[model samples]
Target: MKEQNNTTLMTTTENYEDYKDTTFDYEHYEELCVKHDIRRFAEVFLPVFYSVAFILGVAGNSLVVAIYAYYKKMRTKTDVYLLNLAVADLLLLFTLPFWAVDASIGWKLGNAMCKITAALYTINFSSGMQFLACISLDRFFAVTKASSQQNFKKRCWAICIFVWTTSLMLSITDLYFSEVKEHNGKHACLPIYPKDSVKEVTALIQILEIVFCFVIPFLIMLFCYTAMAKVLLKTPNIKRSRSLKVLLTVVGVFLITQFPYNVTKLWRALDIIYGLITRCETSRTIDLMMQVTGSMALFHCCLNPLLYAYMGTTFKTYITKTVKRFSSWRKQRTESVEEYTMYSESHVEETSSFSI
Candidate 1:
């Protein structure tokens, strides 16, 4: 029995060696995942889920950008920030096709495209969060301060420039780090730093993003919204309950969507720094989990537009009108199709009877 077990172990080891030159053999890897399982539900979830998100996000955010650019024309700070937010979401959504393709098959795009796509993904994600915090700050000011319109415009422009510049600087590092890495005859667009600096740089960036992009921005939004809520609630004439509910809804959505993703990111960073999960299988598990959670974070871009629809009456009016027009057009098309079908059937009957 002991001799048979030893032989089986040797055969298994040899098979693993042979499998490396082949494709991503997930099934065989699962069998070998006794010590630690790298394969998760997300391997199946990502490709399909991200494709859906890409479609919805692109359609929704495009309409928002169009509204801002053509219909509204950026009359206020909110408009500018919302327009930038839509642009950022669009930027993030455009990268989803590359990722969806990569998740379904593998990274067929070469190194340069991989780097560019990854950079855009990270840049837009960072900027989107920054823009959220900016909008919150602008709302706080509008609620509390007596500001000249000119001053508000100047502040908004400065905020936009700062957010774009900072996020760009942060994402520039991805160009150096991201690469087309071949694994098991399948390519992955992975972050690849210098061999010596890889761990340090990766961990450092993750920590920085967690603090700046996630934690700090969240804290800012929390404080601003809380103060705004307080002032509005104290007012006798204000419809206190409705205003408070809207404020709570905004903060609640942010917490629910962003919190888990941020926590997962922080954990991955700590794992990198401390070697908490030392096994290769466990390391791959962390990588896959990050990808899934990061997609969740990106999904907030689409939902952000919905929150604006709920909050801004002007925006909601436009959205309702657009929705009505689309509904009417769809109804007309359905009626036309039914009419065409009936007419064709009658003509066919007349021709068949006469020919006989």
Candidate 2:
């Protein structure tokens, strides 16, 4: 039930798409009729999809980083998690152009690049989801536990360190296992997992991925937001409507886009562990569904800054101020350059007249 190594985050940018790059050898994979259609679709659709994602993801995530770095004097506890989330999004998009090229063409890049790109893709994907958990937990404490501002500030860095360390260790598993293998004269970047190994390491890793990426974060968000909504309703000064809106939107988008991909992965993992794959059509359907859902997950990253960060009035103000300041600076620089050119021309004329 393993897919092509690098076609997607869940599938690791996997198999069907690679079939497109290998012309004469397509029949071998064509035996899996559903997969054959998936491969064809991947060739046409994934390249375009990944390209759009790369552009929007980089632009939106970069703006998030900019607002935090240049616009804000000091970041709050929530801001710390949000900033790391942006970094993870940036990292995820960095590997996308490479995958886009692979989907459009093939893994023309060699094994080293295969390892690098796959590892980066896996790392960021895993870490970004983990940060969502951190965000939820931080909010939960802010609402329920009622820590002092100083205590919360101190906890932010410590919690950040712990979560990032754990996620990096989780990510490094891909770095160790990811490899480039030749398939029908084409190269692919994917994890090296044996289906029937005695150790069952591949299945174990897959389960871990579901747990770390989808399960824990989802539970944390659900519980925290539920409690947060309750607390906000009780508070007299704070407007509950806006906070509730943002909370619901954040949770809704993630679950809708993320559930399918992770659930598909979970299904595949079980199929591999128990040998339950009875029909190629069913498997192929899962493949198509996974590809589409995974793209939605990527889209979620693009929306992170908007859904979580920009939903705040304070954050919107900072973004506005930064844009205005940048525009003014650019205008001033243009005027200064024009003035210098005018002065140089007049000085040249005066000097020429004196010489004559």
Candidate 3:
């Protein structure tokens, strides 16, 4: 019996070793995962991460859109760009429920849904980040040259169209690389590429995203913000208005919310390449760390709307009014319920006394 068990174990190990080279060898993955307890990690944390992401994401983006749509005066050129950002964020949030359900309930949603959801996810991520880059460049030019603002405003619509179109193309790339497959008696959408090519493609795309959408734009934003800060500081002769403070806060929040995510992404790309080439023994640990760090970037979808509230004056006012109205309604509902309960109790007491 012991000899037979040993033979079974050896056969399984040999099969797993051969299977790793295949694209959809989720069975092998599952074996390695069981040996290392990967599902335990997912079960413990994925639900919480996605729930927080969805709730905050939906609320924040909705509020931003509400404020922007409500106040016509808030539609400056900059605000229009922010409106686009808000729209992208909202679109992304709209898909979070699907992801949340998938994480909790398993992939009951079908191949069509898998592809559509994947497309939406990629499109939003690419479009949203690219829009951020465009906004950063616009700011850089506006600050660096007086005439550039006029040119930027004129070209803004064209730039937006380009960003969205490019994003749409990039997002649809998933349709080519990924497929729906059954695993562990459940369906999953996974990227199917040669082992080496899969790693290469992942690294290539991450590098492209970090370089074009993150590092370059961040540097531009850094320069603009630093220069702006210097001008604000040195110009002691000039009085800074509340509006100037507000504008600085807006730019500052953008840097704060986005910078860490970009830095982490760049580092993650390097880590992936390093792990692959060097066959680093620490690859597992690095991958785990990337998962945590990537969540920080994922949370940005939730943070974008908050930035609009902080930066846009009209949004602040509108949110305040909305919150007050909600509070008033809650109070009235509570009072009405209490009053009904008291009257019901008195009627019951009187009936009992009359019967006595």
Candidate 4:
């Protein structure tokens, strides 16, 4: 009986040791699975990228807005669309600095800021893409169906309103779900859906974003530009080649900048729905792809002003006139200052001679 009791105690001790080992192993596995690489890479890459993007995007988009506002250059439906596009780009660019700081030092901003920033990012991004489509459609109408220009012009405001409403509606998910949540020992501003429906919600949102922000706009631009190209080919205008080149550049740049990003987003959506990636390494690779492609996508805002506004003949003329006027005004001010100084000196000298 004594030996049997001793054996039972030994058995219990072994069982406890086994359980502890198992728990430790499980926890160590989870720790290994944590994506330290992603955090390190983002901490290094995102801040610099976001800063550069913010500077260039703000400068370019602001110039577009300033030029349009100062010159009152909303002469055409295209102009109206481009102005709205500039505004959207500016709004989108404004969020970059926040993200830059967040990437550098986690999301120190509270949940409210997280929601606002995320919602603004989504809203302005979708609106900007839609505006690009609107610009393409307007240009197509201008070139192909010149008779419909008046009707399109009348509907421009309505179209702009629709785009804004649609973007806002799409961003409702971000506004609702975005939170400052702790992740891997740091807080991040991201959408955190209900645990019960997290996968469904994330997949749905990503797919919708891809569809509205990229697919629809890309299709519109493609169709309109292709049709325009056909028309240009048949026409005998001297600017046909230049127009074709511009169209190609626009389409090419859009594809190069946006396609890979959307592809990564689509992959992420699929992974959420289907668990396509199982390995930690593979998941980390996807995250890195997302980071790089997203940065590339954000570069489009910097190019929008140059491609859509500054490249236009009328806009170039406005820029030239504005620069010349500024130069002339500066020269006149300098001459006035010189003349005033000389007059003051001459008057002082004359007074001194009279006194003598």
Candidate 5:
């Protein structure tokens, strides 16, 4: 019995030693799992999409800013909001190139630039959405309660200030938590909240962003545009159909561009909080969807000027007049140059004849 007990003890000890030697290989396990090649997709897709968006967005928003500044066209509260919206769109567009590079080749711009760029992106994105809401509200008031014009006009600057301040405050998270980190042997610039609170903080920020940037603005636009559409329908004006179409286009475009992106963002936030995405393929699909949806959302900046132009009679008229004036100025300058050349040639000929 003693001999049997000693043999059993020796077998148990050997089994324990074997188990200790067979350590779990996390990296090898990860390797065995099917890797999602997101970097390849991002490298091919993001730079081209971002480039087009940046070029068109810059050109359109710059023209909007130039027309507003040159013509002094902030004649209404809606105009003020449109101008600020244009400015915010331009600022947001400015951050795309950095992101494009980051997506393609990784973030080489250092930690400070990462933070600044991230913060700027958040600020302008938030403010742009808010300004869209402001514009809708202003137009709603204009159509429904003309008597409220004086109050809105008086508060336009104040409201803009509030939007910008609110956007800035919301971006504090990016400014504080953004950093450059290596992922899969490539550097990325992203917010890395404290490990203890990362899930909670990320989820909270994502929810806040979706609410303020997308949900609230969408609700305001929906309400204001619906009311304005009803008012236009009842007014029996010549431009009523056109106005209704513009309102529909605005709301339609917003929904098409923003809705999917926000949905994906919300999903990501929920996943962070709940560890919802367990499969590697599902995670990769979500990443791809996020990239595609995000690019679509950014494309809205390019459409803003076009949407505003359709919506605003004043903007259309100003754009037409500006084009005509620019053409006339160029023609007159060309004619003047030709006349000066002729005069100089004639003078030279006279001087030569006199010398002869």
Candidate 6:
């Protein structure tokens, strides 16, 4: 009787799989479930979101680069770290158009583009997070060693180079895991592992992402920021200015933006293990949730520039002065030109009167 029941269950499962494949019944429902609601509400909304992210991210990051490049006064030891961060953010934001197009047109861009988009996005995400961790480490060392602190300024450039090079090197994993495939008449970026190694590969990658990208980074950031805060608070009779407040605000932003994502990521990693054991379909929902959270996570690229504006005292002061001086200089130049023209006209009139 038990054997007969097991056979009946196997037959039912096979029939369900056949139904899912041949009948278009549940395909549309699954597609709808996976499609981002913001993308579905208006065809143009995804494009608009991507455009705004690109504009703000590029402009903000470019401003960071320019401030460090053109404004000699803004070039500090810390600016070196920020310069690298801006570069990463800019690259990450640039990839948004690819994602936007995929979401907007429902992945009509084909396989090559899908791979390229995934590669760029993963590279930037990993690299940017790593760089942020580097920044926290820099701060920790700078603060802890205070008087005996080695001059990090001279070494910062080398550190920046290493950060970017390592990022590019590690980001190739995306190509291995992602593939563009036709699903429900739309191309989708699916995580396709080696058939035999799928379970192990998914588990390994998810664990690595959580550990390297989130858990370690968050702990480092928390430690450095906490230590920094304690030190600042202990400095006797030191009145905190608006600038100091801005600096603290920058720390707050990092914690708030990254903490939730990290928590969710860790939970998802554990869920993958559970799925591996139970053979459940939970990975699908996790992937969808990750997409939405990941989109929100991308906002960090935009927010970092704002943090730079508020926290980088040299950048803030120099940029404002430069703008004001340029405005004044332009006004003075216009007045001088007008005066010269008027004088020239008067001289010509006087010469005509004398001739007459």
TM-score of each: 0.79, 0.84, 0.71, 0.84, 0.83, 0.72
Collision count of model 3: 0
Query: How would you encode candidate 2's per-residue C-alpha lDDT over 27-94 as one tens digit per residue?
Result: 44445443445666777777888788889989988988998887775456788889989998899888
Candidate 1 on 1-356: residue-level lDDT in tens? Answer: 10011111121111233223334553456465542122233335666777888889988889898777656767678888888999998998888777766654668889899788878877888888888898888889888986567767778888899999888888777777677765434566766566566557867887887776789889999999999988897788557888788788888988877787778677766754564553546645555555556666767887988886436788777778878888999888777665665678576664454311
Total clashing pairs for each candidate: 0, 10, 0, 0, 0, 0
283-329 in candidate 3: lDDT tens per residue?
A: 34443444454456567767766654455566677778878888999
lDDT of 5 by residue, 272-297 (tens): 66656655567567667777787788
Indicate the TM-score of model 2: 0.84
lDDT of each: 0.69, 0.72, 0.57, 0.76, 0.75, 0.59
Q: lDDT-based ranking, best first?
A: 4, 5, 2, 1, 6, 3
Which candidate tops TM-score?
A: 4
Off by over 4 Å in 5: 1-36, 329-356
Candidate 2 clashes between residue pairs 3 or more apart in a chain or in different chains: 4-14, 4-15, 5-12, 5-190, 6-12, 6-13, 7-12, 7-13, 7-14, 8-13
Error of 3 at 344 (Å): 13
lDDT of 4: 0.76
Q: Quote the positional error of residue 3 for candidate 1 in Å.
A: 45
- How would you encode candidate 4's per-residue C-alpha lDDT over 1-356 as one tens digit per residue? 10111111111111111122222333343445566556667777878887898899998888788888788547678888888999998998888777877776767879899888888888888899999999999889878975455565568899999999999999898888777766545567766577767667867877888899899999999999999999999999999999999999999999999999898778877865665655657666766777778888888999998898888888888888888988999888777666665678576664454311
lDDT, model 1, position 251 = 86
* lDDT at position 243, candidate 2: 80
lDDT of 6 by residue, 46-147 (tens): 467667878888987887787777774434455677777888888878877766665545566666765666677766776777777877777666766653
RMSD of each: 9.3, 6.5, 9.0, 12.7, 13.2, 10.6
* lDDT for position 209 in model 3: 64
Off by over 4 Å in 1: 1-40, 278-288, 325-356
